[model samples]
Target: MGIRLSSVILIAASVGLLSNCSGIRLRQPLRSTEYDWRLFGGSETRTNAAPQFLEPPLKLVWSYDASAGFGPSALSAKDSVLFIATLQGELQVISIKDGERLGWVSLGSAIASAPVVDGTTVIVATADEKNNVISYDFSSARKYWKRTAGPVESAPLSVGRLIIIATLNGTLLALDRDTGEERWSIQVSQPIRSSPASDGERVFFGCDDGAVRGVNAITGNLLWTARTGAAVFANPIVIDSLVIVGSLDSTVYAFHVQSGEIAWKYRTSGMVYAPAAGFEHRAVVGTAHGDLLCLDTRTGRLLWSALGGDAGGVINAAPLIVGNIVYVGTLDKQLYALELSDGALRWQTELPGRMKTSPAVFGKRLFIPVENRIVLCYRSTSGEE
Candidate 1:
């Protein structure tokens, strides 16, 4: 389906951008180096870590009602706009300054991931299987290329000129970012609910086989595979030459990126579903049983663990590491911020609905994709921007 554009209207103190799916294409801005939340886990490392800082006492900057539920993907920010995909099958663009609908186009009947911005084109993969993967160029108001990879439930990882994605059928396809041609492919022969992560030289992911495998990003050659106790649904994070991930068996496994040797494995309170996040040297992860753990990235030593007290809720999304704060959201509709050094509870915000998608940030603002079909933006009112 082509785009059904819309117009942004001036309303009150804030802009009014409702869910009409209007009829005017907005300006397609170029990719900016200032974007810190442009990908699923923010970067190819799948760390969900940002160097930005924002003091508390944040006020709600703006909120945009998308009128559709979101999947396990994230909210991506590129330049002046934001890209989000709804389960109702539309890729929407919104104003970051003020939550206004810039435009939207039908990506498929179902989408479980966010759109990855590649310059003027937005790369998105649909779980609907018909339009499996598509690169739509909003600058020209047309599709750059389309291909059927598989029923992909994760966001496509852009590695330079290649677009990488994982199919539920266990096939990982690496396509040319410019022409949508196949560059490389890998078959794990098991369901890959976890998305792909990279450390420039190699790519990493988890599988249903309870194995965390590392593959060369350039040649698609299998590097090494490390076994775990149960299925590995969380994406692995590469930091300090170690690939760290969590397994459904409630264990966090860390392996050497090159040798695939087990560095360490620490058990959690419950099974892990979301990916792990890291900032400087500490990596944080949440569990289905409402456990938030911070570990040393190099040694896998437990720095501190936040059990099911105030952070009690099933965490389906990864914790975001912004500056020294660990922002965690749960299915129980609460957003908790923990101090990264000691796991001290800084504060928790009450929301209207469940938050299953990971939070993203630019500089001083926080963008959260609440499951109630709305995106809430909060910025520091203390002039930290």
Candidate 2:
């Protein structure tokens, strides 16, 4: 067996973006005040769908220098503050209104994913040997509890009073939000690179064993599992009654949320490292070949596909659906906003460096991290911050 061209490209891209952020300052900017995006996914269900719409012709509001490297994950917004973590385990808090640094807290040796913000409490997973998971209260700047799980590469999903964490060792564990104790645990015996998503009842994630598994979030009981052609590295999106997931085999599978039956599957030109961000029956996603596609969730039909950027820069970040717009950031240093109805390109811009993470929209403001070092905020030219 030989290394594939995609693997070579991914390795090169990863080496280019790996920095951490530290140092902080308090700012006198207005805050979002709303806890819009507290989890890695957009909603409580981990749908990756935005409730509000952001039209194009957006203006750059501000950009903050984090001076650190970031992972391939989405940003979390809550309570007028935005939280981002670096590979070096520095969690930097920024004010959403002005892109000002609120403060900084070093949580672990390395943070592999985004931090989950619940009110003043932040739950983050790290590569620390002693404290892989930590829950801290930001209001008083005090550490609440820390637990040594394992290497957790995915962001923790907040479900009710439990914080769901999937580890590289294939152990799905849920922690109590208040005490950091184990709520439930299950061993699937496979690596879990994909973050867990919920449909209010069951939690779904992709496994390295070429399968997508759904378990009860509260009980940790395995409900059902569906097979794929390759390992699933992208996060699963729960849309409508379907659990949409993409695989390294260049195929996307939609499983019935309740029974785990195959609903529909579609093949792309390249691998699917990016997850789907869907609205209602329409699913918008990006492929590793730099193709942006919109698929019919009910029938697996391709509504439209548009390939953009330079030489199809491999896309690893998840797509964000905001009203009539679908925003995606690619590793080719390009950010795009397309029309959700027809896959028409609406707006495009180049970043300072390659972007491997996804975008988050709170109210009318859009937040995207570029090259794992800088955080950029944008809004409609007519919209106020």
Candidate 3:
């Protein structure tokens, strides 16, 4: 059978079987040098850039059936374990090496935000009527604490001892990572659906009111707020002295990290929904009109743009930059790997469903969570093909 046909059959059979059984249990030890994807954008800055690169012709290594379809929440990895949250209110821990189900926790509510893995603690936010931010001890497989926040659709930000979350009720809350105790809360003018990006000192997030605000991480005081032409749904990526974000108005804005001053702005042909990923002097972003753009980080000048062609769908998931390759998944159930220097298509493949979350890369493997209840793994076989 063809690879796509086999993948569909495997996914169908695995989902039918795994839905009846409890999660898989594996005791594989983590590697010392393995990188951890602790946050939504891979760091407090939300750059969405991988530390290591994997070459083209990535071969399928393994696939895990999530049983239930995944939400917009992204996957997090630590050592060799992958933490995945599903729309069925389940948080699953899977072994990355062999795609074995390790363990899982049922949160009893839908999760739309990525889980944050910090050491042995895993933090996640749910989207129930009264949204909750729960912390779990992965080592003991027990709940640490559950705190109620507003309706949170954005992923929680774990910085040092604080857990930061933005709620749809226009609240930005900081809680103690260990105790789930509220440290501070600041109310913005409109709902905040974007995750907060931090640079250790201040936390940056965008609101539906077309404003991006920065608050002091320690005091919860509003430091500054910058306005855009439309609602800002994408997370802000902080690099150096600039805070970069995309808006629904089809514009990308860079604000001064400290002063909230507009450093530069770049206009695209479509509304921008994905977080911008930066590497070296360039920042890359994807748009709703199926356009991928690379811009000079310092000047906001368009370096190059690539059209996703006829099959390219809306690029909602953030683009992940690893070495010379830029990986992005589209709503059309296609994954594209573009050359970093120029937006040239190097490799593209059709997935089982839409890829709603950004992919995670560590060592030689790429982990992609699809909307079809399958997590696909690919290993780098760069020069072999």
Q: Identify the candidate with maximal TM-score.
A: 1
Off by over 4 Å in 1: 1-28, 307-311
Error of 2 at 97 (Å): 1.7
Q: Which has the higher TM-score value, candidate number 2 or candidate number 3? A: 3
lDDT of 2: 0.79
User: Which clashing pairs does model 2 show?
Assistant: 19-68, 19-69, 20-68, 20-69, 21-68, 32-80, 33-80
Candidate 3 residue lDDT tens string, 291-343: 89999989998999886567578998889887888988999998888889988
- What is the per-residue lDDT of model 1 for residues 249-351, given as tens digits with 9 covering 90 to 100? 9999989999999998898989999988998889998999998999998788889988476638898889998888888889899888878889888877887
My TM-score estimates for the predictions, one after another, are 0.92, 0.90, 0.90
Q: Report the alpha-carbon TM-score of model 2 versus the true structure.
A: 0.90
- Tell me the deviation in Å of residue 183 in model 2: 1.7
C-alpha RMSD of each candidate structure in angstroms = 5.5, 9.2, 5.9
lDDT of 2 at 37: 78
lDDT of 1: 0.81
lDDT of 2 at 89: 74
Q: Where does candidate 3 clash, by residue pair?
A: 24-101
Q: Which ranges of candidate 2 are over 4 A from the true structure? A: 1-35, 308-312
Q: Please report how far candidate 1 places residue 69 from its true position, in Å.
A: 0.6
